[model samples]
Target: MTPNPATEPRRFLEHLYNAAVRRALPLHNTAAFLPPPPKGRTIVLGAGKAGGSMAQAVEALWPADAPLEGLVVTRYHHIPPRPERLKSRIEIVEAAHPVPDAAGLAAAQRILAMAHGLTKDDLVLCLISGGGSALLTLPAEGLTLEDKQQINKQLLNSGANISEMNCVRKHLSRIKGGRLAAACAPAKVVTLTISDVPGDDPSIIASGPTVPDATSCAEAIAILQRYGIAVPGAIMSLLEQGALETPKPGDEIFTGHEVHMIATPQQSLEAAAQEARAAGIEAYILSDEMEGESREVGKVHAALARAAAHRGQPFAKPCVILSGGETTVTIRKQPEGTPRGRGGRAGEFCLGLAQALQGQGGVWALAADTDGIDGVEDNAGAFVAPETLSRALSLGMKIDKYLDRNDAYGYFRQLDDLVITGPTHTNVNDFRAMLVL
Candidate 1:
């Protein structure tokens, strides 16, 4: 028997989302990049949303006889369940994300210590992905953890792009921006990364802990100054004196190191596009490197989707428009004694899309983070239907007011539209889809 036609659109959107995620799973993408057993012990060091899964994949694929031991850090509650028969050799730990904590500091210290005294025959396999910057945190000399945390909060709330934020993180860290690779000198380093940043710039992914950094300390200082974030006097002096510089592209420490992009936002978007075309709908991919303010990006997407839905220009009816990449949200200052809004880029984008859509018929949309968590929130994202605005109006929920408060979660929760897929264990940044029929 065939499924009902009325529910096909929603199901197709979900299928596309799943396809995008499946393409990024470590289990599916790690085997090809696995290096052969080295002359000495093989150590794995990693951090990100996909760290646990990447570790497990390495454990499953590596030769059972050769020695394999290491550690990886991931966001809290993101670790996947180990297989029943697979004995764990790699230690998987939990840490804070989008904000560093004591756990991350300890983990970073341990990882650095482990990299010390490695021989040329030893191998270091680094599994990197999105969110590693926060998961593996070690403050540079003279900078306290509290200071780093404050800067992180400020950058996140300042609407800085990922590149800008990471530029600052790389300079202020003791382990990021190829410092980890430098510590493993004499030992070959192999990095298997999942791209979550715009342009898939390896140096920007998790601040490129295992790759050479092309950004400079001077650039980082400029970003901080442009954003009006104050730096300590000592740190400012270090930056001005070029003492906080990261390893450049030709640094000797990266002599035997290599990096492989295992998964990317563009690949995931193409996966979703394949699913759309298989379902007999024309698929259009706008871009996989989109960046900017989340709400503003949503409004722009809404305009494009509306043009197709209303006038059938650029794209025809019965089509799905897809896009990927990371977007930022700058938290607004709340009034005195008012509670801060809850939601991340995905939900916020949905709010903007719903508002701009204006209840146009035959249009449905979904915006979600591929990692299954949007910002610090539990839900991956939210969905929008043609009646979203009208339903909210009926429930006395003002879209503009909620948007002003940056309360996408509150607005969508009341409508029962939040997408709650717990811990996808992989991240390729944001996945957005619009269906017009």
Candidate 2:
């Protein structure tokens, strides 16, 4: 008999999540996007949560006789366990994510240096993914690493969307916004990336290090000002003068460059839906380009789940609702004596969902980042059941208070509901599932 989602909701949900992740694995999606070995040496350069896996895929598939060498940097502990028999050809280093660190800065510099002297006959294979913006950090002239880190923190807490944030990042970086591609002038550059941003715009992924940037310095300046995030005075002057502009579309340097999206949020969501269907559950994908405040989105999802459960208006019984895309959480200020809340977008969504659900029967939900890490926290996300609100109440936990402080991590931990999955060596942004039976 098929397992019932009502009886084992968490297990069923996790199975679907795993299926989604497996669909985006580099080993499964990289082969088709791989270019034939060039006449000259093939140099690989990459940075992201999936850098290690992407490198391994190339190493395994490329002709063992052809020359292959370069560097890739991934978030610390994100490298997948190497197959014992597989020989490593690319250098995979570890660094920080969501925030740039000294290690990342060094890695970006090295990756840039590798492209400095490529010939027309050489091929540059760039393995980029979602976290590349933070992992590959080469600051612009006159800017310190400290400046980038501080601005990054402000952007994260500013509730700025991915596009807006990346726009700003492209202007401040020495290697992003098509600068990497510009460096490989006269050489063939092939970029194989996994899409984590909504709409899967190649330029927006990892700040489009290898793709021509359509965003301009003026736009970046406007985004920074709109968010009230200040920058160093010199950088602001450069932006105003258009001295920090990135390579735009139609730039000659990008001639013959190719970008292939190996995996994407929509594909992963479809994979999850297929898994649910195979298990005898009807699944509906709400969207793969969702954005906005995490808590508000959760409330909207709650409304949908309640409607399906009570009236079956939009979707009938025994069905799963799914969504993908990155969401933002604007950190709320705390009183001087109080500690700040800890949690990412996924956790915040759950808190809002649980509160809005009001203990509605026969409803369960799971929200997580496909990369297996939510924000900067250890947990990927969190889960919610019908009794979530009531259980918290029993433990002297008030959902409203937690929501006020954006304390989804604390709230979920108290209920033993936080989803903890170590780095899955891939990223396609957020994954959410709601089961209404």
Candidate 3:
């Protein structure tokens, strides 16, 4: 017989997070996922917030006889506490994220150099995960790291979606798209990724270093133009002339390349739903492909949760609504002369939920990033209890004004309700759960 789930709601949430974290552990999944060691030198190279943990995973699985040596770059503070067994072989380098820094630039150059002139006998194992697009910073010729930094900041604030943003990145990069894979010609490359993108397309993940390039220079230019991003004319001309050619599909450069998604957002959401079932709560995953403006999606979620809380239209009460996928914020719409708010999708979703709930007193919810960071803020996400609106009103906080400034993080922080987990060493996008009891 199954035991009763006596844990409180917050505890249950933690249990779900722990379960998801467990599935990500390198010790658990490394053996079966391990690739064969190369006949020659086996070099490791990668980037992303989860790069550190991924490197450790590979080291743990690799035979001691194999020649394993290389470096991985991860977001600052995202590295795991390494065990004695794997720490010495794989070097974990720290880099600035969501923006480029000198260290990241240096790391990118080094990783590029590491792939130089290898025979088919040599092997290159890449541990890629979300944040790699930024963590693996390689500026195009004549472009400074600052230029990349400025553009990256603009892209984040722009309403551009992941694909659009990555398209621009691929064009302006020396290592992204298929450039990195091209650098390691004749040397077989295998990439193991933990996907944070909605569709889990490897070419979209970290801009597909070893994968083919379906997006072209023109597409990148159009994406930049659609968002009103103005780059130098020289850069524009280079793209227009197809000077930046990423390796295309069937480019012989990728014949020996292999890519695999080791984990994904959908998988994480499924883990949460399974836990809900054990608690006797019927769980329905709304969609794993959710995207669009964060606040707007939040409002939509609020309506659904409210309906379930009141008339049980789309779903009955006592059912948990779950979803996964990244939601974006378009800061270009913020009110005039107002600083954008300090939160991400998770917090914004809660704001919309709390506003819609309006003290309804029956629904509870949690939204968070699997990587343990939401947006550009320090918090992963936030939780909304049944009395959230009541508590906010008592504290004299205006949800609409905070929402207007795009300051969802600040609002949640004031209430001491922000979820901060620092780096979970994994990314599968966002995880959301709404329970109506």
Top of the candidates by TM-score: 2
TM-score of 1: 0.98
lDDT of 1 at 36: 94
Model 3: worst 10 consecutive residues (lDDT sum): 1-10
Report the lDDT of model 1 for residue 45.
Answer: 98
Order by TM-score, highest first: 2, 1, 3
Per-prediction TM-score: 0.98, 0.99, 0.95
Please, what are the lDDT tens digits per residue for candidate 3 over residues 17-107?
A: 6566556655565566667786798889999988988888888778877789998999999888888755479788999988889999999
Pairs of colliding residues, candidate 2: none
lDDT of 3 at 281: 83
Off by over 4 Å in 1: 1-8
Candidate 2 regions exceeding 4 Å error are 1-3
Write the candidate numbers in order of decreasing lDDT: 2, 1, 3
Task: Give the per-residue Cα lDDT of candidate 2 at 124.
Answer: 98
What count of clashes does model 1 give?
0
Question: lDDT by residue for model 1 over 96-187, one digit each (tens)?
Answer: 99899999999999999999999999999999999999999999999999999999999989989999999999999999999999999889
Best by lDDT: 2
Count backbone overlaps in model 2: 0
